[model samples]
Each structure stands twice: as C-alpha cells, then as structure tokens.
Target chain A: MRLGAALRSELSKLFRQRGTYAGFVVVLALVGLLTWGSHYHQDRFKVANELGPDFVVAGKSITALFIARAAMDVAMVILMPVLVAIVVGGLVAGERQSGTLRTLLTRPVRRSTVLLSKLVAGCIYAVAVTLFLGLSSLALGYLVFGWGDLVLFRGGLAILGPQAGLLRLAEGYGLAAAAMCAVGVLALMLSVLFDNPLTAAGLTIAVLLVSGMIEFMPYFEQIRPYLFTTNLPMYRACLKASVDTASISISALYLLGYVSAMVLVALWVFSRRDVTC
Target chain B: MSASSVIETEGLTKHFGHIRAVDGLDLSVHAGAIFVHAGAIFGFLGPNGAGKSTTIRMLTGLLRPTGGEARVLGRPIRDRLRVGRSIGALVDEPAFYPYLTARQNLRLLASLSGGARAEEIQEALKLVGLDQDADRKLHTFSHGMRQRLGIAQALVPRPRLLILDEPASGLDPEGLAEVRDLLRRLSEEGMTIFLSSHLLGEVEQLCTDVGVISHGKLIAQGAVGGLLAGGGPAVRLRVDDARKALSVLADLPNVMAAATGDGSIEVGGERDSAQLNELLVRAGVRVYELRPAHRTLESFYLETMRAGKSNDRPDAEKAENDNDGSG
Candidate 1:
C-alpha cells in the first residue's frame, strides 16, 4: 500500500516536470519525420521504377507494417534508449540533486520501497515511450502509405499477408517494449549510483552505444550473446514469418536477467547509501 | 529504555571515512514534562561542525551510524519506516520539486506518510502561515517561506517527535518568531521536539531541555535551566562598595566564587540570596540590589567549550558529570 502511494507520488512528480515530456515529444517528432521520409522515398521509388528497372518494382510496395517496422528499427537503435535513459537517469539522481530525496526518505517508508517504486515508475515510462513510438509510427504509416502485405528481404524474399504482418508487428512492439524496459532499468541502476542526472544519462547511453558497437564486431562474436545490447535486435526476429522462437526466448530471458541483476544491485546500493545531500 | 524517554542512544557513533562526524555520544531524552511544561522540547545545541546535524541525521535514519545503537520512541533507529512514521523531520533545508506548488509538495509528502487528507494538508499550511500561498510554486518562494513549508511538511504526518536541523536558519525575524511560537505550541500540545541549532538565543527561548555538543562529543545534556545555571545558582549584588561586597561574599561558607565587577559582585555557589543579603547588611556593606543571576546557554556553551579547550578529557567528563548530577 505504501509502495503504491510512493509510485503514485513519483509518477505525479515525473509528469509535472517539463523534462519528462520532452523526450516523448522528441520521440513522436522523430517517428513522424521518419514516416514522412519513408512516404517521400516510396513516391520517388514508384517514379523511378516506372521510368526504369522492373526488378525494383517487385520489392517496392511500402506497406503500413513495413513503415512501422522501419520506424521501430530506428527507435530501438537510437531514440527509444535515449528517451528511457533521460527519464530513468533522473529518477533517483535528479531527486538527490534537488534535495527532494532527503525529504522523501525522511518519511515512514523503507529505502527498498522507495527504490522499488522508482524502478516501477521507470519501467512504466519505458513501456509508455516504446508503445507511443510504436503506435504513432503505425498510425502515421497507415495514414501515409496505407495497409498492405509486408515484403521482407532477410536472407531471401519473404512476403507476409496483411493479417499475419499486423500480428507480427504487434508481437514486435511487445518485445521492443520489454527491451526498452531493460534499458530503463539499467539507466535507473546508474542513476542510483550517481548523484548527477546528466552523468547517469550520459553514461547509460554511452554504455549502450559502445556495447552495441562492440556486439556487432566479428572478433566479439563469442561474447556477443552475453551482452545485453546484443538482444535488443531480438525484437526484429518477431517480424519474421517463421519466428526464431528459441532465439527470441533466449533474448527475452537475457533481458530479464539484466533487469533483475540491475534492480537487485540498485536496491542493495540505494538501501545502504547515506543521503548526504 | 524508560517509558518516559522517547530517544535514547548508547555510544552512537558515525564516521565518514576517516572523519568522526559523531563520536561515542550517549544521550537520553525523556518524554515527560520539561521543567514545568507537560511536553519536552530538546534543543540539540552545538556549534557548526559539532555533529548536531549528523546526530539528527542518524536519529532520523538519513545517515547510518558506524558504531553503537539508537532508539526513538522505544524502537531501534534501524527500523526506519516505523520510526519515521512516528517522527517528522526537516533535515538541513526545505527541498521540493521547484515546479511544484506548496500544496502539491506537501500533498506528495503527505501521501508518502500513509496518505494525509486535503484538509490536513490545508491545516498544515495554515499552521505555517502558508495557506494563502499554498498554490504558489516553490521556486517563487523566499527562503523563509520555504523553511515554513519545510516545517509544514514535517507537521503533515502529525508525528509524535519532530526532529529539525537548524529549522530557523534562514528565516526573517517574523518567520523566526512564527516558527518559535509554532514549535512552542506544538510542544505544549504534547509533541516531543528535538531540534538542532547554533542560534543560542532562539534555543534558549524555545527549548526546555538542551544537549551541548562539541567536536562530535556531547559535552552536556540536561534541563535547560540546570545547564545554564552551571556549577550552582549565581547571584549578582549591586552594592555601594563592590570590593567590600566581594570580600563579604568570600567569607560566606556557601559561596563558591565571588568576583567584583562594575558596581556589582557576581557570586557563584549554592546559597540563599536572603542569607547573603543578611550577611551583607550585618557586614556594613550597603546592598542596593541583590538578584539571582541566571547564566545564559551561550555563556554556558562558551565556558564548556573553553573548559574543553583547556583540559579536553577532564572538562568533557566534568560537563557530563555535571549533567548527570543535575539531571
């Protein structure tokens, strides 16, 4: 019951601050821009194909699901983590900086309860941003390009009917939300460790960026499976006609493990930490 | 722990890295009448860096003590949630989300402390004289207003024990008086207040019990009157011949120390003023006025610090012994 109150309080404070919604606005704008760019490129492709290569016309149909998938790809790789990092990074560290955590901790609430509430709030924010990005992309995509069968060229050309494509997109969005939550949890752990919000957010993003870069290297293939960033792309697997269930499950498990480990560490450190500020 | 005691500590120590912020300090605050009053108002008296704030933090569970244990309202300090619910605190300064209004900030804190109703929040604001300004964002609040808001937040839970650290540090004269009256009123209403401040005059006016700390060690703890009336009851005699009065007072068996000053002789020791007056009358010294001189907490604090400086071990021990003897 106390945790619920704390969560409500945290969410209220989170939403009241303008910085909290800034990330959402940025994500929505990015999605809108991406959709428009895709539509414009698709129009250019139609003109090019009509004037020249018949082969280009075979793989050129821009379906709503395809636009969503493309937008999700961009979001997962860059904007989504950034959005999650900004909010989660400020969860604890920002409060510490403002001296509000001192006031909060002085209440008749356990340290663990406060930390858990923050973690839950960060997860909620992560899910919200991810879902917003996914839904906005889908809405904008359908508005511009119209719904149709999704064609993919992964390994070989595969075409999925509209209904199957829509289901895959939904599954992909769900998996992407989970991945973003893990990223948010990781950022929260960093937030608990640092008193500076910017440092926490910057370090979280930097770690993600560096880990992602290293995960793709041929030499790091052996350790790639162990890296949390490697599983971020696992959401893409949900887009396939014959989904790699084992790989997707393993990726989900990895994200779960990462989230659990980060939360545990964060809880331990935060509960023991002195509120010097 | 005694039933009347609300806060007790046994060698409670907190060391930040190598710096001993709070040394082996033992303190007990009884939860009964202070002097003639029905409630206790303990003034945690100390100079800056004297570990007053550190002690408050530990008692409030903001800082973990390195050694020893403390109990508040019969529960161990480590039981933070339980202890916290019973105690309302304002540590350092008032801090809130800048964009949030006074009412919003209080409401947020109130919810954390088992959910305070809107009327309760309004009442707290009214008590702090912030009811009119409750809708103003905290960023627009002056330092004094923020301090009042801090007090209001502490009062929101209607805690049994209010632990404040320099609560009136940044307040104006009117704000200070308001706080003083608020705390005094709260104490009278049966709230146990334990506030730390270097503002000796404010503490002197508001507190019934005082604990003097220096260099992380509690030099003295007892009733404010006892601590201020150091050594014994003091009498200041205004006489025609100060030297003669001093000489007369020196011969008195009960008189401890007598020194002649500007038109008066300050006498220290346990002795009746009437008896001394009679002695002066018989000894041929014309006594114009004879009044009991109460030593202020400031003088007592300074004397304690001076004594500690002269002989660190014996003075601290003496202060503690004095406290015990008086308490």
Candidate 2:
C-alpha cells in the first residue's frame, strides 16, 4: 500500500514538472527526425530483393531493405540512453534540492518506500518514453517511407515478410525498451548518489562511455561479455534470426545485479540520513 | 502525572561524529498542557551547541539518539513513520517548495500525511490565518505567513503531540498573538503543545509548565505557577496583640514569616490568607488587613532566571532578598 502511494506520487511529480514534459516533446522530435531520415534519403518505391525483386542502385540491384531495417534498429539503440537519463537523473537528488522532500518525509512514510516508489516510477517512465519514441518513429517511417521487407540486421540478414514486419518492429522495440529500463535504473542509482543532477548525468554517461570503450579495445576480447555496456546495445544484435543469446542473457542478469545493488544503497543511506541538513 | 506523561526521555544523547549535539538530557511532557522550553529564540538561549534541536529531532524521529531512552506515546522513537504519525514538529525553519502556492503546498502535504480532506485543509489554513493567502505562491508570502503556514501544516496532520521548535521565529506582535491564541485554543481542546522559544514572556503567557536546558543538560523543569508562586505568594496578615498573633501565625505551616505590622502583627507567605485571617480572629486577635502580595509573572521570571544563572555562584556571594531579587 505504501509503495502504491509512492508510485502515485511519483507519477504526479513526473508529469507536474515542466522540464520533464518539455524534454519528452524534444525527445519525440529528435527520435522522429532520425526515424524519418531512415526513409527520406532513399526511394522506398524502388525495391530490391535477391529472391524475387531487383532495383538499380548505382546500376547494381542492391538490397536496400537490409539498410533501412538496420537504420531502424540503430535508432532505437542510440535514443535509449539520453531519453532514459531524463527519467533517471531526478529521482532523489532533485528532491533533496527542491525541499518538497522534507515535507514528504515528515509524514508517516518510510525512506525506503520513497526510493522504491521512485524506482518503480523510473521504470514506468523509461518503458513509456522509449516505446512512445519507437511507435512514433515506426508510424512516421511507414507514413513517409512506406512498408518494405523488414531485414533483420546482425551480419547477414533474414528478410522478414511484409506481413510480419510490424510484429517484428514491435518485438525489436520491446527489447530496446527493456534495455533502456536497465539504463534508467542505473541512472536513478546515480541520481541518488549525488545531489547535483548534471553531475549524476555526467557520471552515469561516463560510466557507460568508459565501459563501452574498454569493451571495444581489441586486447580485452575476453572481457566484452562481462562489461555491462557491451551488453547494453546487445538488444540491437537481437534483430538477427540466429545469434548467441547466452551472453546477452548473462549481461541482463549482471545489469539487474548492478541496479538492485545501487537501489539498495540508496534506500539504506536515505533511511537513516538526517534530512534536516 | 505518571499516567499523564506524553513524552519522556532519560539521558537521551546524540553525537554527530565527535560533536555532541544533545548531551545527557532528561525531560517529560505532561498531556493536555502547554509545555515550553525557553533559551532559544534569538539563538543564544539554549545550551551552546548542546543539541536542543537535536533532541527535538530525535523526539520527532528525524535523528536516532546515540544513547539513552527517548519515548513518545510510551514507545521507542526508532521507527520514524510510527513515531512521526503521533507527532507534528517544526524542528527549525519551515521549508517549502517555492514554486507551489501555500494551498497547493498544503494539499501535497495533506496527501502525504495520514489523510487529506478539503474541510481539514481549509480548517487548518483558517486556524493559522493562511486562508486568505492560501492561493498565493509561497514565495510571495512574508516570513510570518510562511511560519503560520508551517504551523498549519504541522497541525494539519492532527498529531497527538504538537512539537513546535521555534514556531514563532518570524512572527511580529500580531502574528505572535495569533499563535498564542491558537495554542491556547488547542490546549484548551486537550492538545499537548511542546513549544520552544527564546521569548520568556511569550512562554510564560502560553505555557502552563516549562523546562530549561543548557549545554545539553536540563537545568530546570517545573510548573510555571510553582516557579512563579513558589514562595506561595507572600501574604500580609495584620492583627492586634502582636505577641500572641505572631506566635499563633508562626505556628501555622504555610506562613513563612511573621512580624508586627505597626501595633498589629504581620504574617507573610501564608498560602491561605483568608484562613489565616480567620485563624487570627479565632485566636482572639483583631484582624485588619489580610491580602496576598507578590511580584508579577514577569518579575518572578526575571528573578528566577537571575537566580538560575547565579545558581552556581558561591553561597556567601548569593543574595536571596525577595525585594532585591527582581531589582
């Protein structure tokens, strides 16, 4: 019941802040542009398929289906972090700065419940915002680019039949949204650790960037599976019909551990913390 | 008094790192009475850094005491939510969300509290005199308005024990009078108000009892009447036949002093002046004037505060002249 109240309060807080809604609009616009560009640069009327159809691309019949499908998957992967940060960065630190939290805690509510509410709300925001971008992009893509064979992108492509392309898009976006939820949780943890929003965002982004860089270094081939960020874009790899699920699943488990540990720390620290200061 | 205790603490101490904010302190607040702790209005009243605020924080479950037992509603004060539900405290300045209007802020608070109703919120706002300004953003309201709003917010929860630490900090004369009246009304309705202020006069008027803390230790605690009327309100009894009357009046326990008043005898500090006059007449002495006399509460306060301060002075250097004390 307490957690339910906190969740309700968090929802009101998320929508009440002008900055949050404004950022949501900007995120939709940016993702919409990316989604539109995937089809705008090329003529979707010209179709090329190895099995049946062919199109002239530089006088050679090329499979542009694979390229457009790759673009959609890439857009989902890239938009997840920045959009997720908007939800994650204000979970705790912003409350501390704003002083409304003092009145909240003075009530008969526990600190753990407050943080728990924030985490659940962060999850909601993450999933909702990511999916909103995905659906907007997909609708815009179809409206402008028209439907084509959805090519699954990893290395070699599996051409999803036109009838199954929308379903494929939904499944791909689901995986992307799930990845962003983990990112949101991670960012929420960072928000709890620091008082300044900008610092929390910088630190979370830095962790992601450093982990991504270290995982890509050729010398550390054995460490890629262990790096959380390496698994971060692993959802994009899910577009392939056949791929190793073991590493991506393991990364998800590791991400869960990191998120749980950070949230627990936030709860523990906040529980006994003297909010008077 | 034992059954009436609402809050009790025995040597409750809290140390933040190496600094002792609240030292070994013992206090008990009786239910249905206004209890005030004086020594911190202009900030120099309480024990210097003894953690009076810390003690209030611990009592409100904002901070866990490092040592000693502190009980509110007869239970330990660790579980903040349970303890918080029973207590409403304005430990320091009222912090509010600047962007929100006073009413909106109260609405959010009421939602967070035990329960919220339109009538309760409006009632609380009216009690604190913030109803007229309820629609104004908190930033536009003056400090006194915010202080009253804080009182309203603290009272909105309808806590069993209202713990207001410096609730009157920013108020002017009219505002202070309003707070005093509100507290008087609340106490009359059986709400135990434990308020702290540096204004001795204000506490003297509002509180039925009081406690003084210095350097994290409670130096004094007693009923305001006892502290004021401790000498039992010196009474003068004039009667003819000085010899027998002085002896007879001295024999009575309540009379602290007996002397001849002109040709008549004088009996002072007789708790029951009427009874003493009756006794003198029954003793076959013609009684003339029989009336109680003493300094006012203000004079008594100044004297007691002076005595309490010089309490540590050498015995020979101390003076106990009732007349000279206030002087």
Q: Pick the candidate with the highest DockQ.
A: 1
Count clashes in each candidate, considering only residues at least 3 apart in sequence or on different chains.
1, 6
Model 2 misplacement above 4 A: A35-40, A43-80, A217-221, A241-245, B1-3, B29-48, B98-104, B133-142, B199-201, B228-327
Instruction: Give the least accurate 10-residue stretch of model 1 chain A, judged by summed lDDT.
Output: A45-54
Candidate 1 residue A189 Cα shift, in angstroms, is 0.8
Report chain B TM per candidate: 0.77, 0.68
Q: Write the per-residue lDDT of candidate 1 for residues B155-238, one digit (tens) a residue.
A: 987999999999998898999999999999999899989988878889999999888777678777788877766677667788
* Model 2 chain B poorest 10 in a row by lDDT: B35-44
Q: What is the lDDT of residue B310 in candidate 2?
A: 49
Residues A1-277 of candidate 1: C-alpha lDDT, one tens digit per residue: 5889989998998888898888889988987888778767666534244335544545547767777887887778888888899889999999999899999999988888898999888988888888888788778888887888876555445678889888888888889888888888989999999999999999999999899899889999999998989887788887655688899999888888888899999999999999999
Q: What TM-score fits each model?
A: 0.85, 0.74
Candidate 2 lDDT over B1-327, as tens digits, reads: 233456677778876554555666776544322233322111113533435677787877667788997776656777567777777767677877666778777777766665668788889999998888888888798889988998898887687778887888979999999999998888777677787776767887777777666545666667777766676556555666777887776576645443422353333443576677777789998977776655334444433443455453332122222213534
Model 1 regions more than 4 Å off = A43-60, A217-219, B29-38, B232-294, B313-327
